[model samples]
Target: KQDSVVEDISAGCGVINFKVNRKLLVQEDVKFGLTSELFNTLKRGTTLVEYSSPNIAKKFHAGHLRSTIIGNFIANLKQSLGNNVIRMNYLGDWGMQFGLLGAGFGQFGCQEKLKQNPLQHLFEVYVQVNKEAEHNEDMKQAARDFFRQLEQHESEAVSLWQQFREITVDEYQHIYKRLGVHFDIYSGESFHQDQAQEVVQQLQSQGLLKTSEKGTGVVDLSPAGDMSSVCTVLRSDGTTLYITRDLAAAIDRKAKYHFDEMIYVTDKSQENHFHQLFHILLAMGHSWADRCKHVPFGLVRGMKTRSGEVVFLEDVLDEARARMLHNMSQSKTTKEMDNTEDTAEKVGISALIVQDFKGPLLSDYTFDWDRMLQAQGDTGVFLQYTHARLCRSVLLKITKLYLAGGVSIFALCDLYSYDEVLYQSAQDLQPKHLVNFLLKLCHLIASAHRELPVKGSSQVVAQVGRLILVDSLAFNIQLYTVPLCTKHKLI
Candidate 1:
């Protein structure tokens, strides 16, 4: 029997290799540019992705890095598959922590220090107040009073909280710009605080709200219904808890966006929180809760600098850029490029993204600057290097081939596997598959570049070589255009 797709099948060394018809592969590549077919196969719909929800009045920590990049990748992937994506940053703006900060500011804050360095000043105030509150009864009462004033919408307390929020957001925008990340909405726990009361009322009306002996509002979640597993919704003081606000936010989002799906990206520590959230939503008769998902990732241990453990995300970014610049300076092939700092920054970010994405999302990994910044091996620096080398060596020839209306059969074979990886990535919501695929493609293209020299080849052979290079370049360009690689600035 003859196969149209598989040109030849041979067995070797405990493996069977099936060689695809190159001409057909090139024809497909020419017709669809490697991903159009897969994109067409997907069902387009609106997707709401909530991620990078850092608390206000605090520095963006390295722990948030995983959520930021992972959520960005999911949004980018969904959008690439023709889904309408809403990127949301659900900020932690309202909480008891704010109460302490507010009281601390009143006692020990400096306006000049705040103006000079907002996050650092706010952080110091928070730390100092927490330490004092440990032994000082007056400090504890002050924090409670300040929080009560905020809850009551007192003008003075409201004004101070708003200023802190504004300053934090302004500073965060600058850092987000550096990371190439953005959000369509900057919502916070405060946004749904009022709605949370309505949620409690609904829970009461539905007979789902139960009062514990301690007078806190909770929902029984255990199978035995013996109050073994409970989800708390309100405090004894009647203030809404985190889950209460989350329920309100979910209901509000469904009414507003009518999305086909919603994804929450957070650390694995909050797995039970989201679990109870969705379960309670289902119990509340919001069937749309079925479409909601929680994508949890593991921690990045040892994410620190020589100075100390990293508290601010800016510190990590600066460290990566500085380390990358130093490494570049040591390289003999390093040439002066325009915006060298910008290039280094982008590449350093790529290193961070790739290191985070190269393994299973639920598996914690240690961060090593020396390992990730290496110019060789399975690092992002190597990925960028490959792209640069291909661009410098064969971009002009690839352009000529494109103008001639010819597709590269030489590289189509390597690209054929991309669609499978992409489809798997979308289905599983895992980026490791895509990362590994790109790394393998880089190795294959590098090998092809070495073996297939175009400088002295026949016209047909040279055209084939150029086409191969162009396919790789085109694939990379398409990748970077998407938010995933775009954030990394791989091109």
Candidate 2:
């Protein structure tokens, strides 16, 4: 086997001479089956990933961005592994908040402003109404009245609410496009209102619902049957709470998709809420609730842009793009571009995603612009730069082997190390492992590009073998990276 392999040495254009042993194992020769084997063992069932459930008429905050990207990553990974994955964005488009928004819109909303920017106009109205309702009894009553009308589906209230929902969803679709995220099902609490009512009635019939002193409905989730823990289902005003709607949504999804598992992506603060939701579902005799899961992430604090504090998703993305654009403009190595803005956007978003993924999902971290956008270190900017360099180097019109003479080819290629890193990345849902792996790969490729001659080589077989190594490196980097960026629309 060793003699069967080809060996040669090459020197060209003052480039360093290197040799390839006959028995050397290039990256292509190393078989990595750990990740593939694990993936194949998965049950191959449908998975519904519910994430980024932002409320209608509200600014898209940092928490929503975390959920959005994290959910997209999970969905992408599941799909890559052959699961039937469904990405669901459950909007918070119901409850007393809508009542406040309705009354606020009635008081402060301008039709012209709404026509120009529906979401922004509605958000301003909501903020103003909230402030006024705090000190004015009349405003509070008006909000309640508006919400009551909505609950009753009064023609006027329903019309206004429908318009609000449509406009908000339309705006969200565009923003999601910018991020490369999409949803197969866009549902909300409003869609399950009737089902929520049905659930309450059913719980009452089963004697699982108890009326509290305040005229509220509660479900005892205690394992000892002592009612130590309770979950609220209905408010005193006979209005369904958020959990009730969630119950309806879960049951509805189970019936519709028949998914083997459902995952909810949200901040850690809502961990208890999900616990109650799943518990209540189980208590309600839904055996499938056992398969439901909540993947809670930590908070991202102090996120801002050049303008000011980050109040919306758009601001964060825009900040990223602007800063990246500035950096690219100043860099001597930056290639002249047709679409500088698009390149900036992709690179900027990559920086954010890499920063976010570098840490544990449950560990809160303060966002820093300088650190994340740095051209060096383990930042997203570095990742993108490295990938671009690898692509450029591989595409260069040259061919020369760069391995040191008499050196073990295994040490140079590090095929086993790459396999191990990839296996770890696949096992753990963190991107840091993969990020580190690609960083190291980039360093190796850079060394090879500097020392190897691709255009003119004395040894044809050695040149071809080294070119194969470069090609393998580029392919692996793209294989891991393209999915992440594409899933988030950052690419």
Candidate 3:
């Protein structure tokens, strides 16, 4: 069986390879790109993604990096596949932690220091207060009193909390901009405190809320009606717990967004938490909880800067940019470019993302700056360098050909596989497949560039070169344009 599209079929080592016609491949790719019929085949609906979620007034640690990027990737993938995606950042802005922080601020906080460096001042205050409250009975009482005041909506406590929350959000926005991430909504546990009380009332009315021996409000999750599996929703002191606030948040979002699905991205430690959350929701008669998902990722170990153990996300970003700038200066092939700092930042961030995304999402891996930023091998630096070389070698030439009415063509073989990989990535919500696909494509383009001569070749051969260059460039732009590649600028 022979066809025009199949140029040759060969069998070797019990495997068969089909050589696809280059011209037909290009035509098909163009059709696929223009129509996007593949995505149309998949069901499309509104998707809500909740991620990042650093506690207000606390440092954005490296552990948060996984959730932030993974959530952004899911949002990007959903949108690309024709789903209406809503990115939400759920801040931990309430609970006993805030009580301690409030009391600490009242005792040791300085207005000038807070205004100058809000997070730093708050962190210092928190540390100092924790040390004092460990043994000081009076200090512990002050924290409880402050939280009680907050719950009662005392003007002074509420005012201070509002100020801290606003300042923290303002600072976080700048960092998120650097990472090329944004959210449609900024929700917090504070917003649901009152609603959480109402949820407790509902649970009690439904006879699902049980009082444990310690006077805490709990829900029994055991199969045999035993108190073996219990989830606490309230403290004995009559305060709402994390799961209580989460229940309120879920119901609120369902009413507001009416999304078809919702995903929560968090560390693997919270797997049971989400399981208990959805189970409780189902038991409370919210069947839509069945559509909810928890995307748990493993921890990142040994992520440090030259100063010491990294405490903030800003430190990580700065360290990556500085190291990348030093590497660029030492490279013999580095070109003079505008906004060199911006390029270094993008490349460095890409290195971090590629390293984290190369393996299974739930596998804990050690972070090594040297390995991720390597110029060769399966590193992001290699991917960026390959793409830049392709742009330098043939982008301008291809543009001229197109301007002169030359027929446009794309790559052979991989174009078909690219779509399949993308579809699977979206379906499974895994990024490793797409990352590997792009890396393999980069290797192929690099090989084609070395062997094919485009500058002084016949029109047909030049078009073949154009096919490889254009398709590779297109694929790179499509995948890298997302927040995954953060601030990527084409050469």
Q: RMSD of model 2, in Å?
A: 8.0
TM-score ranking, best first: 1, 3, 2
* Model 1 lowest lDDT segment of ten: 403-412
Between candidates 1 and 2, the one scoring higher on TM-score is 1
| lDDT value, residue 237 of candidate 1 | 91
Clashing pairs in 3: none
Candidate 2 C-alpha lDDT tens digits along 1-491: 22423355466898754333423454345442346666566544899999888999887778999998888877776776678999999999998888898888888988899878877788889889999999999999989999899989899998988889988888888878878888999999899999999999999999999987777899988888777878889988787888999999999999999999898999999999999999888888998889888888899999877778765677788888999999999999888878999889888888888888777788999999989999988777777776666556455655434544322333455444544554455455555666666666667666776777554667876566666666556667778665465743222
Tell me the alpha-carbon RMSD of every candidate.
Answer: 3.9, 8.0, 4.2
Error of 1 at 316 (Å): 0.6
Expressed as tens digits, the lDDT of each residue in 1-491 for candidate 1 is: 34987889998899887766767767666442445665676644899999999987665665688898899899988988889999999999998988999999988999899878888888889989999999999999999999999989999999999988888888888888888888999999999989999999999999999999999999999989889999999999999999999999999999998899999999999999999999999999999999999999988888888799887888899999999999999999887888889889988998888888999999989999999999988888888888777765466544545434344444436566666677878888999988888778778767766777655567876656566565556566446436465556565
Model 3 agreement with the true structure over 153-202: per-residue lDDT tens digits:
99999999999999888878888888778899999999999999999999
- The residue ranges of model 3 lying beyond 4 angstroms of the native Cα positions read 1-41, 397-399, 403-411, 456-476, 479-491
Which residue pairs collide in model 2, if any? 179-488, 179-489, 180-489, 398-454, 398-455, 399-453, 399-454, 399-455, 400-453, 400-454
- Model 3 has an lDDT value of 0.82
lDDT of 2: 0.79
**Predicted structure 2: clash tally:** 10
Clashing pairs in 1: none
For model 2, give the 10-residue run with minimal summed lDDT.
Answer: 403-412
Candidate 2, residue 442: Cα displacement in angstroms equals 2.8
